[model samples]
Target: EGFLHRWSSARLMGRRSPSQRKRDDCESSGEDFDEDDEDDTENEPDTRKRKGGARRPGGGRRCPCGPTGCQRLVNETGFRLPANPERRLAWLQCWYPPDSVPEKYLEKKQFRVHECHFPADAIELKEFKKSGQVVRSVKKDRLPDVPFAQIRPAATDQPRPARGERQTREAADATRSELDRIREWVQHGVETEDLPQGSMEVLTAALAQGQQERDKHLRTKERLERTEKRLSQILSERDERERALRAEVRAPQAGVRGMNALSYARFCTDRWLKKSMSQWLFFDAVEQLNAYALLLDGYYPLADITFVPRQRAKKTVPPADGERAEMRRARVNYPQNRKPALALTPRDALVFWLFVTRSGMTLSRAGALFHISRGTAASCYVTMTEYQLQILRREFPRLSAQQIRDAIPDRFRKFAKQQGVKSDIGHILDGFEKQFECPRDDEVRAACWSSYKHLYTVKFLLGMLSSGAHYFTSRGNPGSVTDPDQVETSGFLDLLDEGIDTMVDKGFLVQESIQKRGCICWMPPKMRQNQKEATAEEADDTASIARIRIFVEHAVLRIKEWGWFSSRQSLSIQQADLHSDVVFIIAMLSNWRAPLIA
Candidate 1:
């Protein structure tokens, strides 16, 4: 029956389903199968249908190929499961039949064998079966068996008594006792029995002493404050007194104007006017004028006028009889006498001299002093002063003419020379010639005396020792000197030349080499000295020179102090000489009134 059954099952399994048949044919030819055909067959049973419509004689129908079922077999040997039919047949064509059987049955058989091969370990089996029981037993053992009622805290375990409460009660009792003691003490007063009688006395004495010390400190502070106030008051008063004394000392000297007679008066008057002059104008003006006059008289003299002309001229005519006779005749025929025109009234001249004596007074002050207007004063003063200076230079010779030509620089000298013009010395002598005809013998003699006297003044002003009383003892008998004779006999040019050389030799004037040529250089003496010799002594000498040189400056300044020298109109020779004479007189007066040393 087994043989028959196996054979019948193989026969039944040999038949292919309609889809399998189609799939096999398609695989053999490498054709595509319709995917819809597989879907249509999905509901169909996975059973093989035999050919000739016969049923196989098996308990269940199986594939005829058995382990090598024809329906599962692909062409030749191998096979692949079809995909959704399009490339399915092509894919299956490359497959070969399996080399071994599938492991599904083997895996199931091996699992069954594994299960039967060994039982679980005895310990594991026991633990798996008794786990719950053991867990219950452990939970029961870990838990306490005490009754719920016994778990409550005993009444004895509740807070017993607090010692603080007891202590507080005791403290309250003690405090009550203390209060009773305090009340007793308050009612009876603290007993001094514990303290010694001497101690109490000592305490009382200390308290008294402290109170006294405080009182003493208060009194001291009060006294100190009073002393400070007093000191401050004293200081304030002292300061006031000091200020008053200073004011008194520094108060501008009452009417004693010094070198600045006119200017000081004007300044005081102006100051007084600004301060309180509405009520004191006339008084102040008179005071100022009087103060100015006082200063003038103190520093200036009235008998100091000496008239000299700008030029000393000598007449010329041909000599007769013999050469000497002809020369003498020529000399006699020549006009000799010349004098200044417009002589200053003695008062007017004195007023002007006084005005120039003060350092700061100008022509305007002279006008005020003489009651002349400023313009008239200035014009007359300049003209007269210039003429007088010229005359002084001509007659005195020592005073020296201050020619503007001296101010011309060497650069201009070259230009002057190019233009056929001479240097300053030449120009000055030429100008002298044009202004003055010539000097006569008598006039020349007078000039010599005048020059000697003027030289004395210059030496005195320059702080040089005068040739002394012995030399000038007899004013009428001036020593007849060849130098003076030469100056007298020579022309004005000769005198100028001699004067220039003498001044240069005296170190009062300097000559500089300009472009290899000599020219006059006017500078302070100190500036001309050796640099290394500029010591204190040299400085003092320079200062002395500077101080005395102010007289020379003042002589020049006086001419400017009066405004006449700056007149536009040409002055007559006599008037010019008179002006020069005024300058000479003023300069002489300044020297005369200058402070004399014993």
Candidate 2:
């Protein structure tokens, strides 16, 4: 340092010794210094004082101890310097004993780290004589006065933010503070009593609004579904009402009003509206009904009963909301109300009734036949059926063995009468299946589906006298029912005498029950693969039974001549309902007609 000072003083005074004079000559010579190498000398890093700090005239400012801020830190902070001056900036925190009391700090120069460094890792560790636990040395709380630029500002600086931005920043700071507290609690088991302040209300309100919006959309969807259902129901009701009104308006033009041949010819022009004049009036088969109604007089009204043209809607018109129709329609009356307040003569009624029965026409067609609506046709049929049954009930008393035996006509009773044996008179028994209804459910379909008929049907136990007339009909039951069960429940056994002969088909399974009641049931022989051949007597008996049982088929055919029995039914039920009455009426009508076979 003293040599450097002397050199600086001599350079300033322009006085130089011999060694310096030689050095100056060599440095200034062009032979020693190349022109290209001058830039290298200018750009090289120097250990001299930097330019930013306050610089004095003498080379650079000196520290309070001697020259640099580093030297002052070394002297005051008890850090020992290396023996060689070149090694001064190479050491980091290399200090001596700090046991002595601190001396007064120098006011002129501030201490700072020139090149901060740490020790390198050593693979070989030195063992201490102390315990196994390793306690590291701690650092002091305060640091020496260092002249770092961040510690002393060269220029005054202040931040600028908008009002909203400022508030947001403050909120962020508060959140960060809370997070720091939570982190401290997690890491060091530390906690704070109060939560950080921020706007949780705004977030909760926004969430609630979104939830309400979603619920509103859901409610709107449900309401729309309900409205759609109601509209569809209303539309269906409107269509039905329109159809009823149309039928009412068009009913009056259907039938021609007269008994003369001209009126009959005019009505027969459209064959679908009424039966043809040749088939109804000129036909000999149906002419007897008019004579019979005349012969029976007041006892039989089936061929002469009449009904006014009633509007179909009058029966089933929907009541207006909160109010009922003034006249609640009454049910059809049978024997008491056979005659309409105003109607055609008995001859016209007979022609219409026979035409409908023989033609197998629908009730709708029956309505068109006599200038009436469907409702009027239904009422007429219902009343006529009841009246006919009431008359027969009076004429034919409850059947006893003697009466049933006596009912056989000339052809069937001839053999028994000639043989002088009532037991020879036979009653044929069989089951007839009629179309019932369609089932909607899978289970219902399985139950109602008939393996025999290959369709839905209702089964009935039918009996026909040897005279080819219907004797009795057990109420209709499910097609799946066993024939023997119907035989047991029909109460026909009660009317049988000690030796009544009943003929039946092979499928009837009721042969044993008839025998138990002391009645003989003749069924056709059944051939099984393993069974022995039947004797000639069994074969003859089977053939004879089949011949006699065929009359049951004829009787059933006569009943099915009505379209009501032949057409598909709207509902399925057993023998106990209104459907049973319909079957009962059909059986009675079959007996009323001429014998089926001859």
Question: What's the count of clashing pairs in each model shown?
Answer: 35, 1
Candidate 2 lDDT (Cα, 0 to 1): 0.55
Among all candidates shown, the one with the greatest lDDT: 2
Off by over 4 Å in 2: 1-249, 253-287, 295-297, 300-357, 403-423, 440-447, 532-537, 566-586, 589-598
Span of ten consecutive residues with least summed lDDT in model 2: 115-124
Q: In candidate 1, what are the lDDT values of residues 1-598, reduced to their tens digit? A: 9999988897687655667777788899999988789767656776654542322454222212222122221222121122234332222222223444333322221111111111222112113465554211112112112222243333354454575554356655664565555446547777645545654554455567679999999999999999999999999999998885454333332232233322324434456533542122212344544543454444443235333224566656644458766656666533344344423443345335434433334545454444444554555555445544444344333323343335333443453365353544222100000112123466543443324333211001111111100000001112222232322233322223222211111232213321123343222355444576677866764554344233333333433333333232222333333433443444443343333212
lDDT of 2 by residue, 1-598 (tens): 9999998997898675444444567788844645565566555544344453434455433232222223322223232223333343222223322332112221222332322211222112344668665332112222223443333343335553465663467766765665555666657744333323333443344457679999999999999999999999999999998886566434554333432222233443545434544344323332444455554456764344555553233334554533433323344233322433544334444455545544556656565656655665555555555555566556545566776666665655554454355654557877677766766677766766778888876777777766676666677676677778778888766656666677777777877777887877656888777879877877876765566566777777766655556654533343225455556656765565566656
Model 2 TM-score is 0.44
Q: Local distance difference test, per candidate?
A: 0.37, 0.55
List the lowest-lDDT window of 10 residues for candidate 1.
Answer: 466-475
